[model samples]
Target: MMVAVDSTEKSCLSADGEDFFYFGYGSNLLRERLQIMNPSAVLVSVGCLKGYKLAFGLFKGQENHWGGGVATIFPSPEDDVWGIIWHLKAADRQSLDEQESVKHGIYSPIEVKVEQEDAGEVMCLTYQMNCFNYSLTSPLYKEVMCTGAKQNGLPAEYIKKLNAIRTNNYNEITPFTMQVRDILQHLQINTSE
Candidate 1:
């Protein structure tokens, strides 16, 4: 899906014009998770999307690879969702879209205005779920988001809210979760350096 850009929104393209900004509110907020498929992704800034709230739901009532619901954003008049702004090569767009399951009709790309402290309002590409049947996310999935939020220095109140989210209590270690765990471990180690 093509997102229309408004003239007033700040451009966030890289110098070569071969990169674009993406606002990641869900699993993509985790650097390791995003880097797995889109290696060109680089942290740009932390921002908040006003007038939207974070949500989790099953896609077509089916659990995702994470073994439970996945994260998405929905319109909320008084809320704001805090997340990371990533600068990525234009070549990674297809892989990023696939990671969000856009081709499966699970998500649809949308253009949003993110309020950044340093950059002001910038137009970015983000995704929202097509289905909103509320569901619980897996414990590991929630952990990934919380870790990313903390690691990236999102607001304390927002991190507290993320920590308060209830999980599906999926304790069994799936192969995917195991890989994610390893990535998180490595990320933790690297961040400490």
Candidate 2:
């Protein structure tokens, strides 16, 4: 079931004027990917959103910039989605929304309660696809998610689940795919140093 965010929850999410918490389960799970646009984001903790399952889909019959499906969450009583909690400056909110294509109506911002190991339950801002039309993600896109999952130390079982997701296996070179590859390469190099 979808939990509504009450006024109290909203206050708690942004108690301070400067920052707020964001739950990232998709490509945004990667620090480098997020920082490309929202540089002020900082890793706060890892958390799990119960009663939801990870899904990949095309938004309104349109493929994502990566030329494949993108990640979103759906309510599922028996499932849980693990992801990173990022604390970001309030000023970065617009950039984050733009990154998620909020203005385009591809994703809608929602509030979710995430269970954190040390902090307990906290309300955070997350996005869900407006329309869920199942589609396979590209191999490179899935690889980025898997790499982020491992980087954040998510459970082995969850990582395995992420890896098991079938890909479109798109190998044809395109500008969008090339851009993603370049970003991944640059981020990997920076992390190593």
lDDT of each: 0.84, 0.82
Question: Which parts of model 1 are misplaced by more than 4 Å?
Answer: 1-17, 189-193
What would the per-residue lDDT of candidate 2 be over residues 1-193, giving only the tens digit for each residue? 1122222355423424556788999898787788889999888777899999999899877856676888999999999999988878788888888998888899988889998756677788999999769999989889889888988888899999999999997776788678768888887897899
Regions of candidate 2 where Cα sits further than 4 Å from its true position? 1-8, 12-17, 187-193
- The RMSD of every model to the true structure, in order and in angstroms, is 4.8, 5.1
Lowest lDDT 10-residue stretch of candidate 2: 1-10
lDDT of 1 at 113: 89
Q: Tens-digit lDDT track for model 1 on 41-72? A: 88877889999989999888986679888899
Worst 10 residues of 1 by lDDT: 1-10
